[model samples]
Target: MTMSAVVMRKGGLELIETPIPRPGPGDVLVKTLANGICGSDLHAVTHGAELVDGFRAVTGADPFDLNGQVVLGHEFCAEVVENGPGTRGTHAPGTRVVSAPFLLREPQPVLLGFGGVDTPGGYADYMLLSEDLLIPVPDEVPTDTAALTEPLAVALHAVNRGSLGSDDVPVVIGCGPIGLAVIAVLRMRGIGPIIAADFSPARRAMAATLGADIVVDPRETSPYDSWRSVAAVSDPARFGRQTVSFPGFGFRPSVVFECVGVPGVIQQILGGAAPCTKVVVAGLCMEQDTFYPTFGVLKEIDLVFSISYTLEEFGQAIGHLAAGELRVDPLITSRIGLAEVPDAFARLADPEQDAKIIITPNAR
Candidate 1:
């Protein structure tokens, strides 16, 4: 039998029919229910070679040769249909689940979706999942919501990177899916007065809905001004101490999430932040970013870079969704079929388009 999948070629995406794969020993064959289009997916299709080169430069090895095609999708949920030979587990067929995309074949890590033709991903009718990586979705969590487990885990990990305090004023500079996820998780942790900045009005509105106490358009009004006002009321002593002030602005950020990924944003944060602030970088910036070292040195800012989440973090993401602690419904802007994936990918390139687009492979 054949299944439809969205394959990433040299420069674009194509919906192709491929043989339905059977799981090997210690593996499970999953029927894909929902797969979310990620910002990384957008980067992969648009800059396949560059991404591959960057990965190779960092890891000193390539998971897959960039010369070949690969299926794209790491954030997804599926139903187990068959447990492969020698698969030892209690999970039976028809169990809804999600898994970490990293598969450990040897001692090294192999990415499921981006690892080329050998390890296909969830942008298809079915995918082969490693048994150890599977995490069952609760009955209360819808399939669409469960599909967000991966990205939410990412957000959780990013948030964990920051040292958040009860009275610390948090700021998020970017209202993309990751930024919104950060806001949601912070709210769950009871962190308040989150100041979010974005150029897009729709994203700013979404940030407001996702528990951002204050949302500002970077193009119109500086987010620094709004956050400073709140910081003044929160900590008045900083105003009296001129030594820690930045250009006479006594307000300082406890932690700032740089989710924008573009250049200069980090510099902007460093320039405005007070001394000893922590700035977490969660965005996937492909190119080299230049920031003013003098500002970072003067502020003594702690720039922390976050990557993938741990298995425990992934489970916690599902728990939050099941417990209704995290908001997933509002993030979903569109549901598409396998055939529409190419167009959907293109549509997501628009800065003003939807937030999250889920691909339902089984849907007609």
Candidate 2:
């Protein structure tokens, strides 16, 4: 007997029946209840972002061996249907949780899945997760809210990189789900004068609700200058407002976070650095190495890259959702079943939608 999975084929994603995996010793079998449609999933299908590793290996005289493929989701929540025999003091029956989704190959191994890395993910009915990678979902958190654990963890990681000060003016360049999340988490941490930039009015409005002090629509104005009015160093020519001080030419930020993963935006982040500012990196991409020497030499900026969250952060994020400390209900715009994934992908890929689409795999 088998359950079902939403399988991605040559040109599109489809639903298919597959074997229900049996958990071996030390394994945890999860019956997936909900999974978030991550931005990385959009990149995976369109920009070839998901195949960065396999894409690299096949280039320049390497074995063109394309191997295994599985379901496609990383931001998710599941129930422990079957726990392995050797797993004592572990997740018992009826325990629901969110998986880190890594394969758990220890000894300081490679990273995989989520938005940043390439790995098989969780767009299915029943999936296999390592016992260690599973974090308990709080009882007060609904399954859909618990599904947001991964994105919230990522947002927390980005905000933590700020070394955030209470009065510091923080700016987010992209107001996607992750960007809005960064906005939400930064406010929760008491950082103010937050600015969120994106081309969509809907997104900017959403960001405003998420606690952003100002919203910049890249479609109408430059995000950099739009933020300048709020920043101490206001450029009168750009903002049409005077009486604001500049951090000095070639100024860096106290801390800056880059949430939009584009090559040009990457350069902007490096260029926008203020002296002694820490760049809390949070974008996902497969672009080649891009950086300029003058960026560091001219500004004396600190560039730091944060990949993913530890289990502790995951737990904290879950607690926020459970306690209603972090408001995510406004972030989630739509809920759909397995059959609607294709159309869902199309909409999210457009970059015009302001809401995060969550998937309910168990919904029939």
Candidate 3:
């Protein structure tokens, strides 16, 4: 049987016809209805080798090797249409569900996002997966809406590490989807006065809509520029520009979440945080260098790295998003069908798009 898919060819993407993949033992055949184009996909397409799932590095491997038509999406919310032999009977047809993205096995573990480095991705009509990873999407949640669970999982994980409570002042240093989710999650927990920093005014504004107390554009108020002299580097473009053009805002946040994944920003956050303050590197700063342990030791500050989410964690994320505690639907600025995947990726990669963009694979 033929299936429609967004296939990645040499330096470009094309919707091509491919055979539907049958689920293997311990696997379920998921009919992908919605997929989110993650920043990692952009990094891979541009860098030719982005970190798969943020954990392992895959280089010139089978799926990512020179000439393979690798799938390009990581965050997918789909439904189960069929099950393979010996699969658990727990899953049923037409179940509203969001999966863990990858399957695992004994002896060899399945890393949710990165393990797909060698396996076909879920950006197609049918994604094969071992039963252990898939979970019910939940009632009252449409696939387009729940597709956000994956990124939300990430945001929740970061928040969990930040140790943010209703009383803490939280600051997120990036307005990407995950960054925005961080702000929303904090708000849902009754955490107020959250500050969102970004170069994009659109993103900053979106943060405001989501519940950010203040939007700081480092382009104008670079986080490093002493707040006393924050106006020196003040520039509107710093907050929403394509690059980190601003000096930075003040350093009063007891808990800092770095989501931009830029080395300089990470450095700025690390050096500027108050002694004993905690810094959660939410965004992957690939170029970040190790700081002198003495700084952390002397300041009594803590640095934690948050990658993916666990089962319970992912569930908590969906609960908040579904319960309306975390208002995220408004952040979904655009939705397009399969044919628009390429363009969607382009716009998402571009700095102009406003809020989180969701790809409705079957929107057409």
TM-score of each: 0.94, 0.83, 0.82
Question: Which sequence of candidate numbers ranks them by lDDT, best first?
Answer: 1, 2, 3
Task: Residues 1-364, candidate 1: write the lDDT tens digits.
Answer: 8888888777777888888887777778889999999998888878777777888899887655555778888999999999988788658999999999876566665687775545678898988888888899999999998999999999999999997876678889999999999999999899868999998888888898889999998888777677777876545654422444454645544788999888777888898765767899998887878888988877667899998898999989998999999986889999999899889988887758899999999998
lDDT of 1 at 20: 87
Candidate 1 accuracy as lDDT: 0.84
In model 1, which range of ten residues has the least summed lDDT? Answer: 238-247
Candidate 2: C-alpha RMSD after superposition: 5.5
State the lDDT of candidate 2 residue by residue for 3-97, as single tens digits: 76776544356787777766655667777888889886676566543455645665542111122343678888889888865666388867998
183 Cα displacement, candidate 2 (Å): 0.5
Whose TM-score is higher: candidate 1's or candidate 3's? 1
Error of 3 at 254 (Å): 0.3
Q: After superposition, which runs of candidate 3 have C-alpha atoms over 4 Å from their true positions?
A: 9-11, 50-67, 105-119, 222-253, 288-298
Tell me the tens digit of each residue's lDDT in model 3 across 1-364.
8677776655577787678876667877777777777777666666544343232443333335425576777678877888888887678988767776666556664533332223446567777777777778767776777888888889898989987644456667898888888888888888756767888878888888888877888878754333223212244442211212222432233678888887576567767655556789888654536666666666666789897888789878778767767668876778777788778777886555845666665555
Q: Which scores greater on lDDT, model 2 or model 3?
A: 2
lDDT assessment of candidate 2: 0.71
